[model samples]
Target: RVLVAEPRRIAARAAARRMAWLLGERPGGKVGFTVRGERQAGRGTVVEVVTTGVLLQRLQRDQELAGVDVVVLDECHERHLDADTAAAFLLDVRATLRPDLRLIAASATTDAEGWARLLGDGGTDGGGVEDGRADGTGGGADGSGSERWDGRPGKPAPVVSAPGVSHPVEVVWAPPERPVRPPHGMRVDPALLDHVAAVVRRALREREGDVLCFLPGVGEIARVAGKLGGLDGAEVLQVHGRAPAAVQEAVLSGADGGRRRVVLATSVAESSLTVPGVRIVVDCGLAREPRMDHARGLSALTTVRASRAAARQRAGRAGREAPGVVYRCWPEAEDARLPRFPSPEIAGADLTAFALQTACWGDPDASGLALLDPPPAGAMTAARETLTAIGAVDTAGRATERGTRMARLGLHPRLARALIDGAKEVGARRAAEVVALLSEEPPREYGDDLAAAWRTARHGGDPYATRWRQEARRLEHALTPETSARRGTARGGDGPGRSENGPGRGGDDPEHSSGDPGRRGDGPGRGSDQRGGGGPSRGEDGPGHGGDPRGGGGPARRGDGPRGDNLPTRGSDLRGGNGPARRGDGPGRGGHDPARGGDGPRGG
Candidate 1:
């Protein structure tokens, strides 16, 4: 069996389709693909195409990869976190477990020598090690390598290069005349959009083949597509991560019946699958990079200058079929200032999922792995805290039984916790539906209220709704009791009420409500004590005996009052207010803090 891993689902499906065509069979015949929430493999399948995330999950389950013969890591140049981690772990397996397993990492414009070194080719230095042992003298178990296995460190694996067909691509500098606002917060300046649209019109009028324009993201793609107006005789289609599958298919299928096409797409079209009949390329000179504000706990996509490597990849799209022209929106001098390569996702992304995977892999701190880039220390600490809060890991930083279950669910650790806890509160089906919505946020058109969006997607007819339904079913299946039993582990019994007994549960007294017998609830000079169930003991000279007077000192702590159940419940609405505000209240009355109780000036 052969495994082909792609970065995105669309690319995996495209590769599977091309392989099936080459094999002279239908889509699910000898070649197949398996992406999240979808699978298209059959009994006779020999080559399986899958996303990098899917491949990582497979590695976690079966370290030995019992039956697979070869694994191909495609698009390694992208340097996605999953691909990088998968490559590192595969190297570990090849070195210690399966020397006979063949591993291949393929890319178009990657750091060949760096990857060659990474793949055990000692590079030009001849300093690679074979078995990672002190002596470094072990050979392959299967005797496939007389010296050591392919990619053993210090042992250089042969580099195989295949040259591509020659095609001249003319570079046309089309920088805007005036300085425009740089891309910020997903907004490309209108000035840049106008210039790009004009260039597209010029390309259509002067050039012959279809025009492929690159934008930073979906929002920009939509804006530019709208700016293009009516393309006299050409079809204006947009392709992005969230575009409908049919629209993406149309873009990839090419224009039919001699209709000239202008395909406005995001970085998704930079590489991977080729766009047929594309002879003109319009580069926007901007791309989106994943950024995390660790201090503020906010993660969002930030607009950034397109890297030189990405520009090269985008320009090559135009020349895939024939000689073409690339229209760059930035000046040639600016290219030198752009980053040479895109930042790896591990450097800035939230590492909660990666941390959990590492903990489950027996490397809690991820220090033992042979990763290209070690995870950041601060991010890993935050990840472990989140796992602990979710009851996925114990105080010792070991994966609990629940942690393994959460990891297998294929959702982020936080979302998995929400689903598991929500199921206990609500039904499993309802929890799954809500979790699915959280997994892939519903479109903005579906509205802001989560419940409303859930209802709309539950009954809506759009492609997103269809995908939501499929994901909901998968989540439901993953959370079933039978599945847990089959996995030979019981669900964790830790709940809010049982697991949160700590010193901070009370104020002032460390022994309060902690089941300590040394401290007495009622003491001399203390006002009427409720715990001892006695009334106030007043002096004889004091006022005439009155009914039981309540003690007044300060707010009662947990285990202090008669009830002894003052622990704050989890997910409680702790906002200060006179009472729950009514709907349609003004800003001051709508959950905003006012100067006083009633309507008054709002305070920060």
Candidate 2:
């Protein structure tokens, strides 16, 4: 039996105890625990073990264990990217390495029954157990070892011919029928922090186990924890990709006597790690993701619809150990808009990891295969180009040895590039720090800085400069102080050349201009032409339009000057300056009286 849990859950002393037991030196023999930092089980004994799911996966890749009676995968519901990959690999392992090994998956909240159906019922074939009861063991009437397979009565290891993987879960709706009123607030009705606090208060009053709250990002989690301030007998813990393992452990297992506890977490908790003893779940119905812009090659983590799978996972927290309650902030109708499945990581995320993984797997093109869903062609192309730029893949479409190493490190391609570059200049220690920061949430200062505005004006561009700044800060804070200092020193010493061939472009005179002629202003009047007296005045129509008619019997020509007929004449002078020049005998030419034959009004 293998109990899979989060990395922080496997404490050193607990691990040692488990190891002692596994070695038959202690009471609970056949039990051990392994993690990234420490691995101590009986030197040779192994029956029941507790391990982080990730470590087990790594071991499977590195070590090939033979002769295993059965592989029991507990807590199969996490659905983490690594977990999914591990499960799939285990299926293959069963086919190749251990054909006789029985695979039993246990999950209190996941659809284990559905999996049972998929694996076919282990029930006897047309042989009723009631008739075979005379044998004292509940075996089939045939009575040929149909029971006692695992030392239990009437329950043998059912031979399961994998009937095509379990049917996809369906969306079930239970309408609240509440009137959809325009929620009165400057922002959304469920101010995430407020919702979490409400859940926390209720959990405390009810003396329920620790409360688990799913928020969108690190900022929200912090904000809510801050709001809770200093509550006695209870500790508030924040969980997300950015938090340290120690902090996460403190939340998973609090102080003695089971004092009330609250955990404000990001989507990482939604499907990856399971927090035991959580009796209440508070869901804010939002998850932050990078809003991607293909054209600009940038993205921002904006709030988006959480998938149905994610929602289910959040709700499952309520019923994990026993029957519990879940408080959804939004109306039922709002939940309906969520996607039926978790957003394919390939589609929404930066493709660096996916591309590198595919390259290492020898499928450089990522062409033909049954991926649950494929990323957009443009995204795929961009990732391939990015990988090529980083020298992870050669021109011949093969992953270089360095690429394999990068994939093993599990980081985004851009960050991987930065790490590689940083390593060459700054050294491995600094490079590792940068990679770690890039993987987690950035710091507070980074989030607040105005200088972190988006470079592009597209949908996925850095529209939310505040969020980017926060992420940058989180990234910065995640690293050790020594590493942070080293990065700063390296950056300062690099001179101007360090940024020469940066992500976009850089030089003494940085230009945002794309340098495309189509983008340049090429119309009739622009720039200095307006001040050069080269274009039409403000209200006046140009060239073929606004002009006097009688002056030239047509529209006024350029450079011909203003028409005189339209000019107002002075009242003092009749035929001299400032007056209308007389034509023939008329003193006032424009007012000439034709009835007097031009002589009366003219008065010569």
Candidate 3:
């Protein structure tokens, strides 16, 4: 009945499990979750936790969302591309399709006014004011409470603030004594890692509770974990996206009462799920951002200084249970220069899949949708060209039947095309196996050759290989030949018929068909031997020839000079001249034979 969308699958599962715990039941609890490759909800479930990606997919299939009454977009401040797109479409539904639907966007450090304006007065200019009372108490006549422009409420949506539980968290600035090279690309200076490890050790010795250290990424976590090995009787754990599910679960479970613990984690631990008993926080003051070099077609993660808002969130983790301490790795004065918020993914991410989704949703340009930020024009054009190349869209930028199928596959458009086309090239099983490897890229040790990686994944004992096999089986079932054929036949009428000449002929212009330059005589100007002009002509290959000379299809008479009696020669004066023709002779003129001028032929 109620939907909660999280940015990541792990977070969704964690939220669902936590909600189920609160319900005091298992197996058939009132709260459940549905993510890719997993579903836990039952018929009696009241709250269904799902990833933003899953929510978007569901909306694409059923715009009305059937029985759903309330949709809570959790962690909206993250600003993921799918979340933003989902929010826009949800707003569309709220505006026109389902006015009764209750949409709630939740976040810890969100731009309250921006979101209130977006969802409040229907994204229009409306203002009001509220007292800046933290305890819902009245303010003094001086208006000491939160005041907007001239004490007027900014929008219709009221800003509700829940006072956080009070806990005295001591802030400790532990900047490195010596200068270290700043984070560049995905690399963090090793010196900073060394300092963070020292801080973790110091926290273990002096602090009372377990230590939770935040690093930029997995690599840094591993290095810091290694450096902290000297801590006797302490259990050190690493938590990252690539960490095994059991390990991540163990990290969240906290350490046994007898042992001291140190948990090294990436930004994944910044919010949402709590690490129990973490009273001392070691902040490395760095985070990774997704970067794309569109010119080189390379996408990678880049390290950057953490935002101040993120620092606050990290510090809050330590105070979840009791009074705590936060050791910031950077100088307190430097915090002012940090970015106020992380960049939205839509602004820089490759939008091929987004373009396909919009096209399938019948909004190809995505102009009609109410997105916070419209997809960049150049990126959208590139995405359309990619879709067109893969037969996902027609020349008119409409989604083809194949495109619809691809979108339903729940994969990137490129990977979907590979899976569909690969299945036809090879067997369904082989294609699925290959696509599964691509879906979760093979380990570098698996080698660069995909064929080798496929073989390794089939026979290797690595965890990645195990996951790949499971995914391959799922893909194989989804892409059976019969199913593919049935889908193709069912939607065959929806797609334009393929032309005999080439693909994308549905919207082709008859006057200027995009045919091969060599394939003459198939349409207008086919018989023309000339480069620019068009007519039936048989003459030497030149700019003025109108047709093929060998076939005599040209407009000129046989054995006639370049300027025949019927054809005018370039620059040949009708009054009989050798050089440039006069404008009085005809229209514009250039070099033409004077011998064939005047009344000799129709020269000039």
Report lDDT (CA) for all predictions: 0.57, 0.38, 0.57
- What is the number of backbone collisions in each predicted candidate, taken in the order shown? 5, 12, 18
**lDDT per residue, candidate 1, 1-604, as tens digits?**
8888776666777889988988888777789877665678877888988776667677777898888888888767666656777787777777678877777767666654455556653232322222211122222222123232332435444445544653778999999999998866334577887888899999999899999998764445556778888778998987654456788788888889898999987666776778888999999887655445565333334556877877877888888889999999998889899987777767875566677777777778877676656789988897787677667888878899898877767655655665665566446777677655544434446653344466688899996688677767767777985764453211221111000000001000001101011111110111111111000111211221111121111222333211123222233111112233222211111111000111110110
RMSD of each: 17.4, 25.0, 20.0
The reply for model 2, stretches above 4 Å from the true place, is 1-80, 83-190, 202-210, 230-234, 241-246, 254-259, 267-278, 289-293, 296-302, 307-309, 320-323, 333-337, 366-370, 374-376, 433-442, 445-604
Q: Among all windows of ten consecutive residues in candidate 2, which has the lowest summed lDDT? A: 504-513
Listed in order, each prediction's TM-score against the native is 0.76, 0.52, 0.74
Q: What C-alpha lDDT does candidate 3 achieve relative to the native structure?
A: 0.57
RMSD of 1: 17.4
lDDT (tens digit, per residue) of candidate 2 on 491-593: 1111110110011010000000000000001101111112110011111111111221111012222222111232112221211112332222111111110
Candidate 3 C-alpha lDDT tens digits along 222-315: 6677788878988898765445678878888878767878988766677667898789999988765544446633233345687776787788
Error of model 3, residue 590, in angstroms: 56
Q: Arrange candidates by lDDT, descending.
A: 1, 3, 2
Report how far residue 220 has shifted in candidate 3, in Å. Answer: 1.8
